[model samples]
Target: RAPEEPLHLVLPSDRRLLRIAHAVLEHPDDVRTLEEWADWAGLSPRTVTRLFRYETGSSFAQWRQQARLARALERLASGEAVASVADALGYASVSAFVAMFRRSFGLSPGRYFDTQAVIA
Candidate 1:
């Protein structure tokens, strides 16, 4: 979680970042593009990146990665398989998802889920 007061909080532009987050959380079936969000937020991509970094204390891509991981974890915990979660999370393929999962947790998804994989 971020601090109470960050160096800068740029999400106040129409609350568009929050809206985009809500949209993703509300309907995972529809993944919104960065361009779409830029339009919705009424800011250029460069400004969006800057504001997103300011508010989240991370680059937009990094934030999106964590968000996608979080969503993947939720779906996985809900009994959804890895392939499905990969598809839903906008991954190019299951292998990509597995790589990311392993990178984040130091264990593959299946082992992580079953508690059989050791953390390196």
Candidate 2:
């Protein structure tokens, strides 16, 4: 039989923060507060806040927003409509989503992909 593929590995230094990252990836659409994430991680809110920064070099809110942006990028790349991707990613409106996309990527979604096409 073929050998099994290796499982994803996390270094000891990163394991503590993996839980938070997994939670964010699993439910990017949910607008839970940091306190909720803290409670779910079985940590005090302040500890979660501090450790998240230490491990990820970003505040929990920023990390979560990045995760949401990553999800939006995937959907947009797959040719999903911008309005549908915006709503599914939990933006209040398409304009809000476009604003965030521009802020994060320095280009609107259409232009972002257009640039990628040129680079490719």
Candidate 3:
């Protein structure tokens, strides 16, 4: 994913899904379950699940993970410390954040930014 990508770039047209998407984007660190989110949005859990897949072409969990990653990339690019970024993103530890970063981008955060610098 591009580091410059905006969080609200493509929102679901459905108001209920839009509400949840906005909430997730605004609070990527929020670890709420789908049922809880659905209740908050005044939606049925099953409806939210199906609508997320239909509208976003991904599951709610996947969408939230991507949002978190986007936020991570933005924060890291702004020169935030790795540990600080991990904590802000609600990772259990810096290592866990690094692991997820590796899985997503095939490089550690430091290396990833170093590479972007070179590419730029």
Candidate 4:
């Protein structure tokens, strides 16, 4: 088995945070739990949260929200309806998603996408 292939290891906390951040970006709409990310990182959820927050200055949930909105922006900019984007991002209702989005971006998703369209 070629010496069983040495286990990949990363020790620097920043490197670990970057890996977790990338995972959030790639799986933005998945609503991954902290336990899921902890398992993937081979660390406890508390450790992941601490290091991620220290390195990124945000909790995993907060960072994940940013990631989801980034993806949502792209989808909306591509002309997908807010309803479909909300559903795809694991939101139970368009209104709920819009409320969260407005909290983050100061405008509703429809208006955000309209701005993008105008800018383009």
- Could you say which candidate leads in lDDT? 3
Q: lDDT, candidate 4, residue 6?
A: 20
How many pairs of residues collide in model 4? 0
Give the worst 10-residue stretch by lDDT in candidate 2.
3-12
lDDT for each residue of candidate 3 in 1-120, tens digit (9 for 90 to 100): 655423443567799999899988888878889999999999999999999888887888878888888899889999999999999888889999999888878899999889889988
lDDT per residue as tens, model 4, 20-111: 77766666666668988788878899998888777666677776776777778778878898999998888888999999888877779877
TM-score sort, best first: 3, 2, 4, 1
Candidate 3: minimum summed lDDT over ten consecutive residues — where? 2-11
| Model 2 lDDT tens row, 84-110 | 998887788999999998877778999
Instruction: Report residue 53 deviation for candidate 2 (angstroms).
Output: 0.7
The residue ranges of model 4 lying beyond 4 angstroms of the native Cα positions read 1-15, 115-120
In model 4, what is the error at residue 107, expressed in angstroms?
Answer: 1.8
Residues 1-120, candidate 1: write the lDDT tens digits: 421311232333447677765666565545567787778767788877877777777776666667677777778878998999999887888998899888877778887777632322
Model 3: CA > 4 A from native: 1-9
lDDT against true structure, model 2: 0.76
Ranking according to lDDT, highest score first: 3, 2, 4, 1
Question: Model 4: clashing residue pairs?
Answer: none
Q: Which residue pairs clash in candidate 3?
A: none
Of 1 and 2, the candidate ranking higher by lDDT = 2
What local lDDT score does residue 81 receive in model 3, on the 0 to 100 scale? 100
